[model samples]
Structures are given as C-alpha cells and as structure tokens.
Target: MKLKRTMAILMAGVTCAGALAGCGGSGSKDTGSAASNSGGLTELTFVMASRDEFMSSIEEAMVAEAEPLGYKIVSQDAQNDSSKQIQYIETAVNGGAEAVICLPVDADGTQSLIDAVGEKNLVFVNRPPTNYSELAADNVTYVGSNEDTSGYYQGEYLANYFKQKGQKEVKYLMIQGTLGQVSTTKRSEGVIKALKDNGINPVEASAPVVADYDRPTAQEMIQPLLTSGKEFDCIIANNDAMALGAIEACKDAGVEINFPIVGIDCTADGAKAVQDGDMAMTVFQNPVGQGKGAVIAADNMINGKKLGTGMEELGALDTSGKDYSDSIFWIPFEPVTKDNVADYM
Candidate 1:
C-alpha cells in the first residue's frame, strides 16, 4: 500500500475499550515512588497497534515499572490500523500526555503523525524510523530490536543447518506482513540476501498475505499456500504468529515434509513449538523492555537528566561519534531446535 503523506493520513482516537485489559499481576510491582522523590504523579499514554500476548506482557511490565515511580499509564489499542494509530496519537497529544509511547502499525505513514505531535511528548516502540536522521524533528525516540540483523541471522542459521543436513538447494517461502513497512522490508531483504549469499534461489510466491499481524488471518493465508502444489523447505515467517499459522496449515494439509520454520519474536508459544520440534528457530525480541525503556528515558528527559539522542541529533549530542554507536539494539537470537529448546526455556 502506498503510504500517504498528506494531512489525510493523520489521526487520533480511541476504540470501544477505555483501557486495554489482560494485564494480570505478573509484572514488576513497587509499593510507590520511593516516597522521597519530588516529582508528582506523571500521566503517560501508550498507543500500541495490536493486542498480541507478548505486547501485553510488555505493557504490564511497563505499567508496573512506571507505577512505582509515580506514573499512571493509559493505553490505546489501534487494532493495527495506521489511521487509527495516528488518531490515538492525536488523542494522546491533545489529552496533554506528558509523554507517549507508540508501536506504529504503519511504519512510514506515522512519520507525519510523529512530526505533528512534536518532541516533548513522543516515544516509539517495536518500529524505528527508516531515516533515523529525521526522528528528533518528529519527536520520536525509538526502542526496538534490529529487524534486518535478526532476519539475516535467522536466514544464515537456517541455511547452514540445512547445508549440514545434505540439502543442496533450499526452497524458501516468505509470509510477509504489510509491504513497505520498515520491519517487513528489512526482514525480506535480509532473508533474501542471506539465501542468495549461500547460493540458494528462493521461490517467490505470487502475493504476500497480509494478516494485519493477526493469528486467525495468518492461519487463513497459510492454508492455501501449504496446498498450492509448491514445495518449500524453509518458511521464513515475519513473526511467530504467522509461523504458528503455517505450522497449523502444514498439519491440516497432512504434509509430512520436514520443513523448518523460522520466525522473529520469541513469544512463549513460539518457544514451546520449537521445543516440540514444530519450529526450527526464532529471534528473541525483548518486548518486555520496550515500554520500560521508553518510560525511563522519557522520565529522565523530564527529570533534567541527559539521555542518549537519536540519530538526528548525534552530532550535536555526541561529537565523538558515539551517539549512533548502535541505534539498533538487539535482545538476542537463539537457534532453537529440539536440542536447545530446554535450555532456552
């Protein structure tokens, strides 16, 4: 989809839920801000794109971490709609949010919304900017795993694993998310480049199925691909949800081929599947730290403490060229198979 740049793409609104549910008492809890700090209760709004279990867990952990430091958390779920995500951001901006943490649904389109909101009230999660140089102008400080590196590592590991197993040509299929988004674009490029470097020509499917990052839609998309009379040895899923969907599709189609499924995002179910020999490997994205980091940095900024600047202000902040030391922070990636599943778990 062509991302719009005009004002028509900007938005901010709330859905049916006043606040997102499903945050149990499993996160880090504090009695209250040490009781000695002078900062009063700070109100923060988090605008997330969807309701994945991993995202929710991170949200809860963030809430727990923030509450102890005298901060209240208000979250808005955009349901993976770019317009709605922008709208939620607008709402946060208008509502006088001290700071906003967002997981952008449409990576490119939200650049304008971030620009409109200004720097005093913006932080990003999961998705970072393609042009990090412009992040500060739009008021975004992004915190997430490196998509390209993660995908490249997954591809390299899978290829080497198959190579050692006496496989000559490895046929690969990609179940991608929305087109042109930073994550999807980088992940696809990384995977393809890795396969090509290893002398493998991956088969390109006719169309990339976009499930809007939903599991049910991914399941629907995979059922057809699994039975399309095409033989694929490796399935490179953009996320674990899609990986699981493809696995389900394989089971339903009764295909006994020993296909290795690789995915990003180390959720519990994905890890469990790896343990059970269903999935080959996955990248462990540190979702839990997303909210917490944003809040900490925003709080530091508010508290007059110096924070690491983004790529936009690197020269101004760090003349020694250390600001951009590693903009793309990665958690870790474990090549989880039946052998290492127990260790990872």
Candidate 2:
C-alpha cells in the first residue's frame, strides 16, 4: 500500500504541471506564443518613398515572391513626402499589418513606426532610419546594399577611365541626391576620394541641382548646365534617372557626349544608354534581390528563427551594431559599362 501511494503521488505531480503549462500557453501574456506567430501567414505592407518606375519594379517583384507563400504585400507610395509616409505607416498599423518594409526618404521620418509596431516587426529597406540603435527593439532587420562600397566602386571606375585617357585633369559636373542622406553623402565622399587619388581635383558643382530622382527635374537641371557654357569633362549623376536627363540635355544642346559619364542604379534605360555609348557606366543595385531579402527576413522573424547563420543574429537595419556588419544578405553591386551592359541587358 505504501509503494502504490508513492507512485500515485508522482503521477499526480506531473499531471498538475502539464495542466499549468496548458493554461499559460493559452494566455495572451505568453511571449513564446507571440514569437511563434511572427512567421505565420502575415499581412505585410511595403511603403516606398516614391512612385517611380524603380519602386514599381520592386512592387511587382515582391508580389510575385509573396503570393506563393500566402502573404499579402500592400504598397503605399508616399511620393517623396514625409508626412504622407507617416500617414501610410499609421494606415498599415491600423489595418493590422504584421510587418512593415519602408524606404524612408528622411532618416528620422519613421520614428512613429517603431512606436506603433511595438512587438511586431519592421524592416527598413534601401534606407535605414537615423538613431536606430535605441529605436529598434526585438523584431527589426534592415536589408539593403552597402552604399559606401558601391560608391567607392563608382568613383574608382570613373577615376580609372580618366587616367586611361591620359587626361591632365577632368572638370566634372556632380548631380548628387538629397543632402544629409547617408546614401548620398557616402557615395559623394567615395567619388571625391577616388577622383583625388587619380590626380584629378573635382569642382563641387551646384548642390546636386535638386533633381529629386525625377527625370523631368534632372532634364531641366542639365539644360542649364549645357547652356551655361561651362565645360564639363564628365557628368556624374548619383542615379540613372538623372544621367538619362543629362543625356537628353546633351542631345538638345547638340553637344556630343565625349566625356565618360558615371551613374548608379543600372535600370533598363541605363543599360540602353551604356550600350549606345551615350553613358559611360552604371552601378547596378539589384532591386529584385533587395525585395526578396526583406520578405525572407520578415518570414524568419515570424518563424522564431535567428536572422543569420547558426552563429549570428542581425540587429536593427540602422547603423547600430556589429551584428549587421557582416549581414550576408547584402546584394552584390557591379559596374556595367558598354563592355558588360550587353550581357546584363
């Protein structure tokens, strides 16, 4: 009787513990329960800063990638406006989006997003927000390319071209992106450093002429550069949109593009220009990969899987931790000149 009583007591203890665990699992306060839902069938909203053709391509690609996985990707284009971006974020949150993928035009524009998401995840693509270290909490990852490295390559390519031609000095026109943006600043710095290294001191032309990544603005800006009678050895634009505009301006001025021009974002038009020898080269930022990576990271976050290989985890996408220093998801960048444009096209 004593032995049977002891066995009965042990079984009773195990049963009680299992019952307690079941109750805890059903409670809304369970953290593990929340983490497990992170990878489920989630509704994600991708808010881009503009409605340009590049972003359209990203949207199309993202739709194709998300459909098979049973996820919905709703896009909100802010048209380069900060207030509009904030509104879109609010809308996404209100609509119960599980995650948000943003391309903030201004670094500090998305602070409210962090507040709204709370435990939900947010992935900043293309541009990481400012002061992200303290802002990014448990569920956030940035997926994009290294702007400085790509810029360095752009600079090196332009510098080498100048040197190969044996030009004593090159007077270049720089059409930069918005001031204070990390992407714009880093790229311009790289180009400037490369030009100096090549025995060429470049004149910092107008304040990037404020093209706003629009072809019309770039075209208008370039017309003045051509009409001003200022001789420029090359027109180095921060993006292919501006470069295309410069090409149009060159055509209107009846000035043949003799100097080698350099640009970033090897879009379809950029590749065509390179093939025609109207533009020198472009650094291709793989938009397809950028979109796919963001979706994959969000899915992993939902699944409770760590953001990296077995040994690592990525922090917030902003310039914060040593974790993202080796983010393997970074897409590759390549210089596409006339030689390589044919293959890429």
Candidate 3:
C-alpha cells in the first residue's frame, strides 16, 4: 500500500504541474456549525501558501488520506500573502472548522494565526513557524522534514564529488528560495557547514540570487551570470525548481555543466534530472509522508490523544536526534543521486 501511495503521489506531481502557479483557492467563508455534518464528516481546513509544484502534491496526498476516514479538507491558498493567510484562518475558525492545517506564507506571523485559531487544533505542515518550539502545545504541532538535513545531504554529495576529483577549493553559484524563510536560511547555512565539516573550502561564485522558489524567476535571475563567463565549480539551490531553472539557464547559454548542481525536494522532474545526469543530486522531501503526518497529527489533537498517535503507519519518523516534546514530528529526507534516483522515480 505504501508503494502504491508513493506512485500515486509521484503521479500527482505530474498532474499538478499544469496547475496555475499563484492561483488562490475558491473556498467560501460562509459560517457553519462545528458539529459533524449530516454525513458525519468532520471538516479540517487546509490553508496553503500557494499551489506550487511540490506543495500541490502534498495537498493531493492530504486529500487522499483524509476523505476515506470521514474527514473533509477545506483547502485554501493564500497566494503568498500573509494577510490573506490570517484572514483565511479566521474564516476557517469562524466557519466551524475543528482543526486548521496550515502551510504558512510567513513563518514569522505564526502568532497571529495562533491567536486566530483560539483553542482549535492546529497542525503546521511543510514550512514550520519560526518560533515552533516555543509555540508548541497540546493543540498545536508541526509536521515536516528538518530543513537543515535537506541541505546537509546536498553538501555531502557535493563534497564527495569534489573530494573524488581531488579539489579542495570550490566556487559555486547559489539559487535561493524566498528570503526570510527559515528553510531558506537553514538550507543555505547547513550546506556551507557540511562542506566545511567535510574538509572542503567553499567559496561563493557570486552573491546568492533569490528566486522566491519559482523556476522562471530562477532562470531569469541566473541567465546573466551563466552568460557572464564566471568560473564556478558548481550550482546549489534551495529546491529542485530553482536547480532546474539554473540547468535551463546553463543550457540556454551553451555552458556545458561539468560540476555538480544540487537541490532539495526530489520532485518527479528532479528525479528524472538526476537520472539523466543534468542535476547531480536532490533530496527527497516526502510529500506523502508529510501530508499523511499532518492529517494524523490534527486528528490526534482534536481527539485529545498524543500528537504523533497512529503516525507510525507512515513509516519511520526521524526526529533529527532531538528529544523534542511530542509537539513536533519530523519526516526524514533522502538524498537521490544517479545511483539511487531510479528508486525515487
């Protein structure tokens, strides 16, 4: 069943690829009773930052896991606006949602969301709030992979590539996700730390360019750099979309990539890129695991059970060696290179 679900999730990535990038959800804000509906279904609100390629996959998995269990997911997209996200949270709460599952637009604005939810169960998915540890409670928890681990895997792959080539000093271009995101900061810092830890002298080829995790923005941001004839040993990106963008930019500029280009989120296209030798490697941030985990967490919280109750069915959960209180649940990230990319695909 896990293998079948995994394949369905991978297929979802392809299906959701054509979804409008910044489109907001059409969920109505009508007020309703919090009690179970006439069909005996409990509604849980799922508010997303936006329906990007990878996020849409998570949404699909969440819906698949939720429906059969007699829970309805009322999904909303904030279109990357924090204000809209808060508004949606209030609307969900006012509309009698027993729980709210949010992929926050601004991690820093988590307090506002907490205040708006006001005693209802809350499960934060994917992007965790900046103050996650401090804010955790019986009714609130986080479900996602450790962001630092994602980049550390990228660095480990790159470090091994360079060490095998007997190169100690490496210059690289970095394509970053949205600034101010904890994922962006941690992923950027974690890779550098891993390279140094593995005895590699890493130097930036240029100041990192921010692309807000958009492929077209990343392609446009790095095109000039690729054409400028800057000598760099590799390219690093916060996620697969930007890495693919960098690959496209290099191809457009006729630059033969001779070095590693690493990223996170082994989306279907990213795994294919690794298999085809375009992307050196990527980290598999499991959407199926995260989506399932979020639903389980919210359900457990609403029932006054442990936050991680019944999550073991999803597979092993890596807590990153931290003895976190029950308020946090981590889904592990796997590194996908040419040798292992086929397994992910």
Best-fitting candidate, scored by TM-score: 3
**Candidate that scores best on lDDT:** 3
Pairs of colliding residues, candidate 1: 11-86, 11-87, 12-87, 12-88, 13-87, 13-88
Worst lDDT window (10 residues) for model 3? Answer: 8-17
Quote the positional error of residue 242 for candidate 2 in Å: 0.4
Residue-by-residue lDDT tens digits, candidate 3, 230-300: 88999999999999999999899898988788989998899889999999999988898788878877776
The per-residue C-alpha lDDT of model 1 at residue 320 equals 26
Candidate 1 C-alpha lDDT tens digits along 241-289: 8888888888888977487888877678888988878888887665555
Clashes of 2: 2
Ordering by lDDT: 3, 2, 1
Candidate 3, clashing residue pairs? none
TM-score of each: 0.76, 0.80, 0.88
Clashes of each: 6, 2, 0
Writing each residue's lDDT as its tens digit, candidate 2 over 1-345 gives: 111111100000111122221122221111232211244645678989887766776677677667676677878888788877778877776666656788886777567666656666677777776654522244655666667666677778877887788875667787777778877777778788877876776775444576756677888887887888787778878889888988888898888888877788888898899999888999877676567666765665555555432211222233232332322235556678887786666
